[model samples]
Target: MVNTRTTDYWSQFIVDYSGGGDFFIANAYGKSAAQLSYDRVLFGSALQVVENIKLINNIIVVDLPVSAFQGLSLSPDDRAFYQVIADNQHLTGYEDLSSAFRPKKRIRRVDGPYEAEYFDGVYSAEKVRFIKLSRKLIEGELQVGVVVYLAQTLQSRNEMAHDISVKALQLVSVIFTIALSVCYVFIWFIVRPIRRLNTVLSERAPTDLTPIDTDAPKEISELLRTINHFMMQLQNTLDRLKHFTSETAHQVRTPLAGILAQSQNALMENDKPKRHSQITQVIDSCESLSRTVDQLLNQALLAHRFKSKALEKVWLGALIKEVSRDQVLTALQQKVELAYIGPNDDCQIVGDTVALKKMLQNIIENAIKYSPKQGVVEITLIIEKNREINDIRPRYGHS
Candidate 1:
């Protein structure tokens, strides 16, 4: 019965023996036959272990001092073989089966005392990793030792890794395709509302300024609201322009008709003084027509200013005085006295100057038109605390 300590010692001894064999092979390089012979003799005691194993029918029999070799207990597929050669000639070696062996590729030379190769075994017809240690011993003399291992586990691991890589690649491709499809759907939903808006605007008539009615996302809805506001403003401007055109035509027609009638009357009058009075009436009508035309033009200009011009600081008192001065000639022609009553201090307001001037002119002109002959048309600018008021009135003048 071999003890545990004895089994361990023999196991270590086997490992040391294998390593020593590689060392011996490498050191044997560049040695003549006589030198090799002499070295082997010197190492005869260490080499005796291998010879003794051979004498025991390649089996390690342990009773008290020896332990059975553990390799003999391994399955045939896991078993390893060892061999030795000298001068490219077989020296001493053994295999379970008779077969030819040749090294197919040099694998690597380990940093230790050994080299290794890989090959296929003709007897088993299987791939194997063959570890070797070799040396050139003098001219035409070489010696080597090799240990061969079956590569079944390595081949199985390689196949498994290839399968895993293929599966991972397939999973990645599937995920990318699904993500692309989702993005395409999302973009389509976003673009659909914009396309609808385009179609509605493109197909409408040029004169159409009606608000658009459509359902959309919140952002697009805000854009639609802005567009609708612009359209409403455009519609109001068009309506105002139409009304102004109609009013201008009516106003002009009245003055023209009056002038024509007065001229015809003057042509028929036999009295010179009466005919001269009729001619004066025609001239007054023409002047009134001219004033009306000017007012219409001013109104049009004010409309444009309202759209395009921003409010500015205006001197209200000065503007009122200027308007009154401009209307003095018209008031005199009508035999109406124009008077301005206001504080001398300048009053300021934020307003459009053109619009304010036109408004004041309209008030004064209307006052003078309605006043009787020898009437006074008074324009007063009253400055109160925190407010300013413009007043226009007509009063009868003393004869």
Candidate 2:
């Protein structure tokens, strides 16, 4: 394709200069005269092309002898192009025109031309492809060559592709920025409720066992429910502890006060018998106080153990009889008859031993305290299918 274009351009150049080459051929005599004609016509044509064509730029016609370089009307642009060729003498792929004029290098009638590239001044050191044409002088052995060049800059060619690439990069950057913004918004929305919940909990007093309220995200609703459940359990535990503390203080204070009063009475009594009786009552009060403290401590320990204790098969009758022994002292003091009568065989049930003992101890102690003096307090263990305990305590005022 480049060969065809070069051939066509060479033909057009020959046509443009119709009579110029013939004029030189007619007046020529010796080799020097032919070289003179060569210099005159080639330089003339270059000047003509520069003047006539407004678009043509960056051209250099060389090998026309240094002597012939003088006496030519040159412009600033033309001088600059000539200087560029002179400076970079070894510019690839542009060779000196003198090489084509070598004496041994014969030019065949039907030989194809080749192309080369050189830096054009208008394009600032950028190589532009040019068509080189050489013709041997018929009258002499000297050869003349002309390099027809087209100057091209980096800024030219495929402007649309460059623009499209730039726009595509900008669009991708914008999309990436938008994606990051969306992720940040989503993360903040999800974490806002949890952060607020933490702040509320941290700011609250240690005694405050209130359940938390929040409009949490649906993804963490189950977590919120679990937290609320824990809070409710905590509140129940706190309430139980408060009730137990108050009851223990009240129960313990009564026995301690009885001991104090009995001791004072024993110290003041003049009769030895009365004083001895008062001393005995003080001793009894101390024993009752010690039992109450031990029971309260055991109840607290039992409450703590309820969560982790394993269930064991326990005989209900034996458990009842053992617990009844503790209350015998209270029953005797109250003048109430405490009797346990149940099945002699193994009445097995699955339960925690400590929990059941505490339960029975509480029931029998209440029964003996409430029963009338010398009244029968019968304790019976009934193993039923549905697993229920029916308490049949005697009426307070009954015979």
Candidate 3:
């Protein structure tokens, strides 16, 4: 009985040891399975976080595992693959699962505080801006891992800016066109009166010195008045010249005829005394002709001097005496006694000397010519209370 009991106890102890060994092995296997399940759950959570970020922000996210870098998690998009480079500057893994995007140079590992970089390049034959981000994970052994974020191209933004510029240019062109049109109209109205004035002047004859008759603005009207005044002065000058020409011709013809007739009469006379008388008459006629020519020349000279010379201080009494002395010969030939009766004191006046002398000479010559034989022609200078007056009178002798 004792041997049987010992056998039973030993069998029982062996069975317990086997069962405990099996339990220890099964517990270790279950703990390993639970840890694997936890890792999968955590990895799934990380992928979900990455997907949520991509959905909210509209960007691509790539999460790479350092231990098994080939088993990386990527947000769902049209992009085909992504290249993962290690901090050692070596390409570690790539997502070759999809055939959507063509192979291109993607994100590079960055070492500084900034995690992103921007570059410009051609993508699918269109200009685009490429934005890349590389982030180092700092939790656990995953610190060796990197997270990449990418943004879409900036083609749309550039197109929007171009549209705005085109609209601004169009608006400026419209404003410039309006300003040009307004200026053209304003200038046309301003020059209308000038064009009419030019036309009127062009159509008139060269000899026509008549005043212009046209409606115009105040400024143009003032100009027209000035032009009319000039025309009137020109017309007066032309009329005076015409009259002077006719008078000169008549005066010259009369003296020449008288000289010719007297010369012929002197030649035909038979008696010596009568011939001598005729010759004397011819000499007188010649002298009269010379005097007439000289008077004409002096008149012309006086007219010119009156326009050109300024007034001067003249001694009126002295000028009168000098003119009287010059005409003494003519007075004797005409059988007239010329006398100057006035105050001996000389009188002063503001006048042109040539003009005053000519006036006095004309008065004395007229008085002497019209006087009867042996008549007295007196040039009297009279001083009144307010002014000086010169009196030329002819006194005839009774028969």
Each prediction's TM-score versus the true structure: 0.48, 0.42, 0.43
Give a tens-digit lDDT track for model 3, residues 1-399: 479768556544543353444434444554445334433433333333333322113223444434322222221221212334334342323332111222365433243353444344545444433334444544333344344323223333433333333343345446768999999998898789989999999999999999999998876788889989999988987887788888889988997888788788878888899989888888888888888788888887887787679999988889989999999999999998888887787778899999988888888888888888888887777767667555444344422
Clashes counted in candidate 1 amount to 0
- Model 3 steric clash pairs: none
Q: Higher lDDT: candidate 1 or 3?
A: 1
Rank all candidate structures by their TM-score, best first, as comma-separated numbers: 1, 3, 2
Model 3 deviation from the true structure expressed as Cα RMSD, one decimal place: 30.3
Clashing pairs in 1: none
* Residue-level lDDT tens digits of model 2 in 342-369: 6465466788988888888888888888
Judging by lDDT, tell me the better candidate of 2 and 3. 3
Q: Residue 359 of model 2: what lDDT?
A: 80
- Write down the lDDT of every candidate, Cα atoms only: 0.61, 0.56, 0.61
Which runs of model 3 end up more than 4 angstroms from their true locations? 1-192, 261-277, 298-315, 321-348, 364-380, 388-399
Query: In candidate 1, residue 317 scores what lDDT?
Result: 85
Q: How close is candidate 2 to the true structure, as a TM-score?
A: 0.42
